[model samples]
Structures are given as C-alpha cells and as structure tokens.
Target: MSLRTSLTAFPRQALSRPNWRQTVKTSLVNYGDQRCGMAATAHPVTQDSTGSKGPTAMVFLNMGGPSTTQEVGDFLSRLFADGDLIPLGRLQSYLGPLISRRRTPKIEKQYADIGGGSPIRKWSEYQCAEMCKILDKISPESAPHKPYVAFRYANPLTEQMYTQLLDDGFGRGKGGRAVAFTQYPQYSCSTTGSSLNELWKWRNRLEGKRANGGKEGEGAIQWSVIDRWPTHESLVEAFARNIEEQLATYPEERRNDVVLLFSAHSLPMSVINRGDPYAAEVAATVHAVMQRLNFTNPYRLCWQSQVGPSAWLGAQTSDTVQNYVKKGHADLLLIPIAFTSDHIETLYELDKEVIHEANSPGVKRVESLNGNPIFIKGLADIAAAHMRSGQTCSRQMTLRCQGCTSERCLEQKKFFAGPELSSLVR
Candidate 1:
C-alpha cells in the first residue's frame, strides 16, 4: 500500500465510557490486516528532512533521563510541591509528600537492591541513543542529522540542547520543518504526557528567542509527536518475542507451562474510577501480545510500582501471585509491560519486592527484557507510523478518559536548565 502520512486530526478528550476493549480491537485489526502506514510521508513525524526553513528533530525524551546528577534537595522539594507541608488543593502535592517521606527509606532500600538508585537516567540515555541510531537507519535521509534523546526529569533538558535543535530545526532542517516524537510504547497521562509537557516549554522559549534574534528562520517551525503506541504491530510483535525469550530461559517443555502476567505501572483507583483508560491500555497491550503469542496457559494482567497514601491501581503482583500459588501453581512469570527497559521498578520492585513477598524464595527469577530488537523495532514502528501518518490520533480522539488526561496538559513548569523536573514544587 502507498504510504499514508499526516494525522487526520489530534485526538480530543476520550469519552467517559468508550469501551477500551473495542477501541484497541479496532486499532489491532486495522494494523494487522496490512502494514498500511509505512512510509515517511507527510512532514515527517520525528525528524523532518524537508530542508525547509526550520529544523525538525526527533526527541525520544523521558520523565527522568539523568545525564546530570540529581539534586537531593530539589527532588524532595518537588516531591512536596507548594512547600513541604500544607493540605493544598493539589492532591498529588499533599499525598505525594506524605507517602514519599514514609516510603522513601523503604523505597531507597529497595532501590539499593538494584545497586544504588534507579539508573533510569542511565538506561534512558541508552534507549535514546539506541533509538536515535535506529531511526537514522530507517529514515536514512535524516542524514547530516540524528535524533537526540534527552531526559525530562532527572536530567531536565538543558537550554543549550533545546536551542540547538530548535535553532537548527529537525525536519529536513533550517526550513521551518522539524518533526518530534515521544518513544513511549504505551501512552499514559504520566509518562508520555509529562515528556511532551517538557517539550512545550522549550518550544515557547524558542518562540521568544526567535523573536529576539530577529527572525533568522522563516514561517512557523512545526513539530509533530507520536504520543503513544499501545497497539502498534511492532510493539506487539516485539513484546511477544521478548516473552518468548524469557520463556526460553525455562526448559523447552516447561515453556508451555510458564504462566504469563503482564504488568504496567499502577495508577490510582480514583483515576480509574474517574475513567482513566490507563488500565485498559495496559490490558490492551498485553492482549495484543497474547493474541500474537497464542498463549495456551492462562494469561493475566496486574499492576506494578503503586505509590501514594490513597489506593493506587489494583491487583498487586503479590496478590496475583498468591492467587496463582493458591491455585496449586508454583512457578510464575511477570513481564513489566509498562517500562521500556530494566529500571528500578523492574529490578527492585518486581524482581525483589514482589518475588520475596510471595513465594518463599520469591520468583525463580523475574525474567528481564530490555532494549530487545523487537521492542526497539516497536519504537521504530511508532516513529515510522507518525512519519507516514502526520498526527498521533487516538481511538478516543473526541474524548479522553480521566487517566487519559495529560499530566503535562496545560501544566506549566519553569525550566532550570538543570536536572530534576524544575519547579515541580511550584
């Protein structure tokens, strides 16, 4: 099929009860029927090679890609936004600190399980670099250029890097043509939304800098983003491959016996009750993989990395494992479907916390899947999709469920040009 680029329209708010099952079913069916949207058509999703007036860059940024050292004070301060104490209007502000202080020591101890801190920053850098190289390979024409993967939290983007890309342009470059994309496999109000929020800051700054610089570039420098790829074929195929690899870690005969549990970051019950499609999206991703893998054993979905005083997303892994154990099952496997790589949540939380908490010896070994070729291809698939499609429209375009709300949506932050989501406290 000929390539189809340019999004028909930006996804609006998802309706209250849009039946997530049906939403994902349509995307999966449409994608599987054929590899329809494959070309880097339109203006280019991540990196625009239009050779136009502005630069188009593909930034695979994350919440915490720490290139710079984290500031302990700032982290805590942000953790307790609008000052350390006070029952402010911000629920996350009040609840986050209350939970953080209580959980920090324990969380720190767990983090130590992974040999210090969440090396999320380190791994993010790795993923970004890997993605950059990956995109360069697929787009080739993105020549004389490369995608820049930066962190939004731990390493908060620096002014220099932002200006460099915005000034130089991404798409084709120097011709008011730059395309940007986010590399989150699954969309969440927290992850992909937060990163895009970060980009908007720089975009605003660039507008000011440009005005002051006297219009060196022409026309508006446009940028596009791939918000999330919950059901992209590349993602499902790659996740299946990853699961198969972990199954291989078991004996060939036992592979079939290995029960599958796909876990993503747990959200709050309030959000889900309010209609956050996050849980549904996570389930959708798992479903896609299971469909592709053709799972014979029972497949299940659970929540991981739950936080805050209020109840977070449900069906804790431990609880789920206990259910399995009660069912006369001994061996069980968990796949962290949310995260891109082996971060603190994966290494400590699942591998250590849940394991030891459940079975006497914990899990035989919480299998690890990171930066797999298929997963990388999934990232590439999304980028390529955006390039051909132009916009990142969602199944619930006209409406967004409660959890579908972007944490960065209309939220403003003051960039310190240093690490740590600057002004998170404010």
Candidate 2:
C-alpha cells in the first residue's frame, strides 16, 4: 500500500478498553473484511477433518537474539551466515562481509554486558505468546486459533521452528501446499525477504531429507508470508502519538531547542549504495511523526550498531553526537525508529554508549524514546491492526530495474566506502 494512506482517525485506546487484545483483534477482523477482503476470501484448509486439523494461517516471526551465548567467534559467524538479521537491501552490502566479521568482537563485548548475549529469543517468545492470545480473543470464530510460531535469525531455535510447525501438522494435508506467515512489522531485505529465503531453503532441504517433507500431506499446506505492515494507519497513529509524548518530556525552554535523533539498526554503506529502502522508510516514519506533531523543531536520522568489516550507515549515534557537539548543538533526543520494542541494542548502544557521548559532548541530556506509554500503545495498536487485517504486506527488495524484477545479489565494497570526511554522509 502507498505509505500515505490515511486510516480512519481513532482515539489511541490501547490499555483502557476491555481485553484490549480482543478489541484490537476484532477490529483487525472487521478491517480485514472491509479493506483487505476477508471472511469469504479467508482460507479453510481442510476439506475433510483429520482430528487435529486447524484453520490455515501460519505466521513466521523473524527476529534477532543472543546467539552469542556460545563462543563469540563461532556464534558471530553463524549469525552473519544466517543473513536474516540485517534489513534486506540494507547498508550491509556496502559494508561487506568483512565488516560483519570485524564488528563481531565489539558485538560480543556488548553482549557480555547484558549477561552473555541478548535475550531476544526469550523476549520474542514473549511477544509471540501475547500476540497469539490477542488473536484468539478477538477472532475466535475467524479460525481455530491457528498456532503462531517464532523463529530467530541470530540466536537459538533457528530453522528448526519452521520444521517443527510443519511437523505439528501445518502441512499435514496430502499435498505439499501450505501458507506461511512472517511477523516483522516492516518489509526490508534482512527482515522479511531474507527470512523468506531462509524458510524456502529449509523447505527445500526438508523436501530432500524427508520423504516429500513439506508437501501438504493430504493437500498442500498453503504458504502465505506476512512480510510487513509498513503503512498501516493504526501503526502510524500509534507511532505518531508515541513521539508526541517523547517531545513532551522536555521542559518548555528546552523543547524547541531539542532535536529528535531517530536511530535504527545500522548495516553497511554498500547496501544503501546499492538500493535498500530501510533508511528511507525510517525517514518517512520520522516525517510522518513530525507532520502529526506539527512541530518545527529540527530533527535528524542516524544509524547505530555498525558491526562487520564493510562500512555501515553513517553518523553512528556516537559520531552523530560528536558532530552535533562539534557544530555547537547540545540538546538531543533519541528515537529508536527501526525496532518496534526495546532490545539489547537499546540497552547497550543507545542507553550506555550514547549516554557516554552526551556526557562527553557536555550536552544538556541524552533522552531515549523507550518505555514511553504512547510508544508501547503504538506497538499494541500496530499488532492489533495487523491481527484484524489478516493479510500479508508487500515485501521489500533491491532491484536494479523495474524492467527486470529480479534482485541481483551483488558484492559490496569495504573500508566503509572507508574513511569518509563526514560520519553523517547520506
């Protein structure tokens, strides 16, 4: 959908309503029926019952985790190898494989701070559980509470989760036909597109390893991927309103002087050089909030967590702080644009390192947008809207031309496009 689609204005009623999850779920169901074409269009896989058959709506939640609990080097390599963690068509291609390798040690040290690695796997599971319950409550009649599963790109429970779901009868039909769901909010290469490639890979291997492994047993289990929800209105409203509160945190005099520093998970410069829309989407979200806020305060976007040998998105938060300091600007506000919820990157990089930069720069203060009520409500609203819509979003990719709708996986340059005059170079 076009990013600017305006949704019906609704009050940000996140926690106040009864069974907020259920309300959102019901809304998603109705909204899906109206906008996305649902109910009659929805699939009911089994023509005949097999005792344990379920309504078909298999979703795959692709996320990052602390796969670093193991020896740092091995885990780091494996994490990069999985290739699902970065935003597909992101800054990484420009940064190249070497950057990922070089950054592993630094990543390991950061993980060490949070007790060996991130609890991404654990927290992802938490998100999954909460979503499943919300879906069941809101759309009990829609489907038989089709199970929602979580998978990771960088940590424990990798491709195995997909296999387990298949085994659990997602494709128990006579044919090798089943649909899959993706649980990432935005569609970028590293998140949705890359995860699908991994899923397809697992399916190929299973097809070879097991006797007609992924083939829908009685019938093919339909493969439907829920790639992203980039332009959903509730999502936008949620985020827009959340940003409003972050702006409110500062005092009147400091408010106008403060700058909103939107930060997202950073990849290499090569990816953006090639053509990843991740940074664009981030900017769009920020602009959307600005429009919603109707504020004239200056704002900027920056990248963080530059891991690997190749150059990643510039103005690493630290560098951004330095640049602002050098330019003689002090007040800054950090808004994590990429992640829907808080993860390790927030705790370590933004919270710890950025704080250090704020101190070093002698700035007034360094504030983060984490734990803001509106932000949390925005997340809940996005999830609720998606559950109601019941349709997958358009996937993101890097294509050379509209003439050839193919994504060419080209190699990227190193040294960060290296040693640039400015850290915040676009």
Candidate 3:
C-alpha cells in the first residue's frame, strides 16, 4: 500500500516468451500472495454462468516527459510530431523535426532546472500503485483493479501498455474490459483525446491477433474512457484543501487579503479555433474549487506554458502576476488548477520563472496534488464512480463542452454507450 514500494521487476522470461498473460502472472507472483501490494494482484470482473471474476485492466494516460537530459529532444520530437498537439496539416512531416530540434536547448534548460528531467512518470507510477490499494478496499467484490501506465509522448508509451494489458487477458473474453483513465483533471483534444486515439489505433491493429487471428470480439478489449472530471466534487475538495493549507502560511488576518491566481497550461489559439475545450474546462475547475472553499478573496484564472511566439490562452500567468502586483495586491497565492502533479511546468515555469518575475514578498506557489491523501482519495472516488455505474467519459455528470468538436471524442462516446458496453451496466 506504500507509494514508495517499487513494482517488482518482471521476470526475463515474461518478455522473452510470446505468452503475455503468463508473463504478467509470473510478474504478479513475485509480489507474494497478498492482494494489497502490487497492481497485478487484482483480477478482471465478468458476468458469466461460471461465476469466475473477469479481469479488468485500468490504464492511466498522460503527457509523458523526458526522464533524462539525453531524452529531452526525443520527447520534444515526439510531442511536436503529433498532429494532435501541433496541427501542421501536410507540413507536419517537414516542420516537426525542425521545431522539435529548435526548441530542445531551451526546453532542456528548463528540465535541468527541475533536477535534470521531469518526475511526471515517477509520480504517475506511484499514484497508480496507491490507487490499486484503494480500489481493493472500496470494491472488494469486483474484479481486482490492476493499474497500468500509458504515456502519449515518451517511455511506457500507449502501445506498450495496451499490448501488455491485452496479453494479461483483459478485454480478451466476453466478460473482459479495459478502462482508459486520463490523468488530466480536465479534458482537451490535444491531451486526453490524442492519447485515446493512439490507444484505439493500437487496439484496432492488434485486435484478435493475440488470441485468435482476425476474429470478431476475439482478443478485443471492451474499452471505457474516463475522459474528463473538471467538476468532480472530490477533486474540487482536494484543490480547495491544498489551497487552504497554503493560505495557512499567511497571518490569519492577512489571509483574506491574498489574491488567488489559478494557473493552467496554455494551448495555441489554433487549437481553440479548432474547437478544443481546454480553456473552458480549466475555468470550470477553478470555479468549482473556489466554490468548494466558498472563497471571498479576489481570484483570477490565467494560463502558462506558452512555447514559441504563437498566441495562446490568456492572460499569461506571469503577466497576470505582474498585473496583480501593479494593482497593489501584495499577497498572491498561485494555484495550479490544470495540473494534478508537479512537473516541469510547476517546478520550473511557475516556481522559478513566475516567482522571480513576481518579486513580491507575499507571492507563493501551492504544491500540486501529488500523493496528497485527500487527492488520492478523490482519484479512488473517480475510479469507484466508473466501476459502480459502468460509465465512462463523464456523460452522466456534464455534457460535452459547447466548444468541443472533436470527432475522436464523439466517436468514443458513441462506442462507449453502444450494445458492446451494455453488458457492463450494473
């Protein structure tokens, strides 16, 4: 149950042999017979006459970062090359490498500032490990909820995770299912959508190839996506609690005077023109958190992580801080509403650059929701919501954003609600 515990190394034969489920089983066995240690201890849940538990694979997706200095360029290249993140039309092939290389040095410096690389993957792994324990406690009757990590643009890529999960017998039978959980608190075409698209592509290409060659429903995973949860009550509570803790640093009387600045990563205007919902969803998250706190102080939502010279969602975080300082607000508490964990954006961009620019005695950055017990409980709540209702993509809570026109998201919703998923309804 400890987040510090490392997943036991997979045996050499697990990778060497063609049998992937056996490989997973071999690896799971190394964690001892206890059901609380590793993610592999969970089995899938299925409905059948035999009453055997159908194994379910839970995959966590995120925008992965470079683990080392040497990998920075590769990470940028993969990120820039993805048409979803940076839409280049036909020029993508020609411009991707150019942009990636041109930005590598400056980006590498930021990574170095944050201790040589981003710890996003490390944090995500720990989150997944801890989440499995929570699932076991809350839903003991369900299939063991095994957790898997899939990154969009780096190591432990989506393809790798999907294949490994499929090999482990998830989505391979009538009762089998796979859950695609987006690590992003809010959804965007560029983040969760892109990751799911990549995942589906792998699913399509490998369908039936593992257990039966090209047979319908043979080796196919019944996928459900947890695309967005900006307004989830538990998540809002976590953010509110974190901000309250940060506020406690100030004198009790002065706390009311502190300006709350909610900062989120910015996306290009081009993406907005194409109807991405990132901006609106981020606003919703900030609003929800503020509501949870019943905050009376003045607050402003701003954007960060604007690369290149292109215009992005605004007002910029740094600029917003300067504006607030100009307005004579001596106290400023910067809350990262769009991010769930600390990484380059929070560690360097906000912590180093924005703080230096603010140059105010009252300026402070709140810690991200990494390994916070309340936040972990919130995530467990999200997983439990999906498990009990057999619902995905948050349709029951909120409608698709008015600005979102993503065909990929539309397709995912249609598929999730179709006859194939009817069996999952509880």
Please, what are the lDDT tens digits per residue for candidate 1 over residues 102-144?
Answer: 6556655555556766656544544444555556655554432
Residue 197 lDDT in model 1?
A: 57
Model 3 lDDT tens row, 1-426:
221221122233432324543533444455334445645554433443131333556788999899888899999999989887777779999989999999899989989888998988877876776677776666665557677899998888888887777666655554366678899988887888788778866776666344355555653577777888898776786688678878989999999889999998888898887667788888899888888788767899988888767678789999989888889988999999988888888999898999888899899998787765556666777776777776655553134445665666555545555564434322
TM-score of each: 0.70, 0.68, 0.82
Residue 195 alpha-carbon offset, candidate 3, angstroms: 1.0
Clash-forming residue pairs, model 3:
42-144, 43-144, 44-54, 44-55, 44-56, 45-54, 46-54
For model 2, how does the per-residue alpha-carbon lDDT over 5-60 read when each residue is reduced to its tens digit?
Answer: 22222234643334444654565456446435555542434433332323444454
Over the full model, what C-alpha lDDT does candidate 1 score relative to the true structure? 0.54
lDDT of each: 0.54, 0.52, 0.74
The weakest ten consecutive residues by lDDT in model 3 span: 1-10
Which candidate's TM-score is highest? 3
The TM-score ranking, best first, is 3, 1, 2
Count of backbone collisions in candidate 2: 51
Q: Count the backbone clashes (under 3 Å) in each candidate.
A: 39, 51, 7
